[model samples]
Target: MSVHHSVSTHHHGGSGAGWLALFLVLSLLLLGLVVAIATAIGDYAIGLDTVFLAVTNGLGLTGADISPIEQSVVWDLRLSRALVAALSGAGLAICGAILQALLRNPLAEPFVLGVSAGASTGAVCVIVLGIGGGGLSLSMGAFTGAFSAFALVAILSNGATSGPNHTILAGVAAAQLFNALTSYIVTTSGNAQQARDVMFWLLGSFGGVRWPDFHLLIIVVVLGLGVCLYMARALDAFTFGDEDAAALGVPVARIRLVLFALTAMITATIVSMVGAIGFVGLVVPHAARYVVGPMHLRLLPASAAIGAVFMVLADIASRVIVSQQTVPIGVVTALVGVPFFALILYRSRPQT
Candidate 1:
């Protein structure tokens, strides 16, 4: 009977792995399709064929007769933008999934946990206040601020012993404090032009991203994903709560610290580059979880692919939503995420 049970379990695992492989392939195809569509959109629309030709031309695969301007737009401006959007989405969604599992809170995300707010404050300090005597890059400042906020949350929550609610409340307080700091810096220190730039960045924009940004972001997201996957078993253990995980011989405290730091690093890098774009983290993980189930190994990659697709689509919507003006990417995401957020809240509410 035991041998029969073992054989059945192995067969079931194999079947599940096959399904996951199929899902991942489909997700990648969908992501590629949307990224292509994103490249083909903009102020001066290019044909999809031209988009493909431009890409191939840039790669020296086939030097088709494409206009210099069209090639530049496709290869230089829009393609990088779309790729960065995809990477940002994947990174944010991964962070969200990791956070949700670690915190065991469906709503746990960088935005909700004040990591984004902290990073924003840090970024504005470098941009407006000239912190670090102009030596500090925005990314580093944001990283410092993000880590600070995570540390503060830990202090307030008393190292996870106070439970998820207490940690959430601590996050609320951290967010308010950091947001207030950002407002004060902008209002008192920044000139009109500086204020405008800072405000626009705060709202989020993919306008400035280029190949260099993509190169950096890709590294961060890939490393972060790898690290999370390495710790997938621990994350699964975390879903059962800390005591239970510890009882299972997991070093709960150490794992929590490392994962929290990783989350801060990814959140800060993205926030510094593109500002605080919320809800990708909040919304994408739930959608991925619904399709892929709760296993971190499957869920992480699914979230990354789904998120890449979602953000590229959102970027396209941002460009075309208004006649000439591009809406902030944050606004587009909020429109979708707010409704989902409300639904989750209503469902998670205590029953009478």
Candidate 2:
């Protein structure tokens, strides 16, 4: 009996150590990727020293001397854009993951929910319609679009009566209608410059992300994740159908409202910051599920981290695609996303 007990303890100890080591390795691997991608970009590649130095220098501290131009490029330009891209991408991916589990549909995402499309419509209105320029107006417009989409979906679904799956269906209906509205605006604009400007913003770029917007994205991302963490138990309950969830003490109605609002706000923030960069939402969650399984507590953070890496790498590729001008990050994402989406559809097809 004594020998058996000792062997059992030894086996369990080894298992625990193995798991702990696995977690550490994965976390470090992801961090290393984020750092490496953050440092390496096109023609004007900065070393690890310059990346940290420029960022510190911005806060009235000195670290190293690269150049005035290089400092400006790394600190003001690249750092903010990279951070924004990472945060937005990660937040959106978490949103997507939540939605997938909530609605129990693999097809669910920002685009499918109509939040992204509605936000796109509002952004196009500002850029093409010339409401206002380059400041609060743009962010406000994008938020308006995002909220409008969520509101329309909610209202149409009769939120009091409809379930989460029902709500997703309502979103599909709303998205189709908003997409039509946006398309109409593009065709009706009739001015080449207006149309081109609208089109470009829709295609997305992190090139000129400003300090103000970057801060806002950070706040929103952090807040959204906070809400997500608090409600993770409800979300996990949501995984097992509504009836099962309710039996397990899940507040179905409240959790639905919280997640919907959180995701909409997050979607708006991302759209405002990066002009509707795609794929990160649809792909990241699926990848995270493979890594960490379906538990929201582990899944959300992992999805966010991996999603951040995904966008930064894509942004890097966008900048490197040409010698003179960088391609819009949106275009790179779309090209990649559409094919990946097709693969997903094919793989998930019912094996009838």
Tell me the tens digit of each residue's lDDT in model 1 across 1-352: 4322432343337676798899999988888899999999888999999999999999899979989999999999999999999999999999999989888889888887799899889989999999998789877888788878888888988975666677788989999999999999999999999999888888789998889889999999999999999998778878878787787678888888788788888888888788889899988999887887778888899999988999999899999999889899999999988998898788778999
For 176-257, candidate 2 gives per-residue lDDT tens digits of 8878888898898738877776677777888668778778888888888878978876777777677777777777877887
Model 1: lDDT equals 0.88
lDDT of each: 0.88, 0.77
Q: Name the regions of candidate 1 deviating beyond 4 angstroms.
A: 1-12, 159-162, 347-352
TM-score of 2: 0.87
Count of backbone clashes, every candidate in sequence: 0, 0
lDDT of 1 at 30: 88
Q: What TM value does model 1 have?
A: 0.92
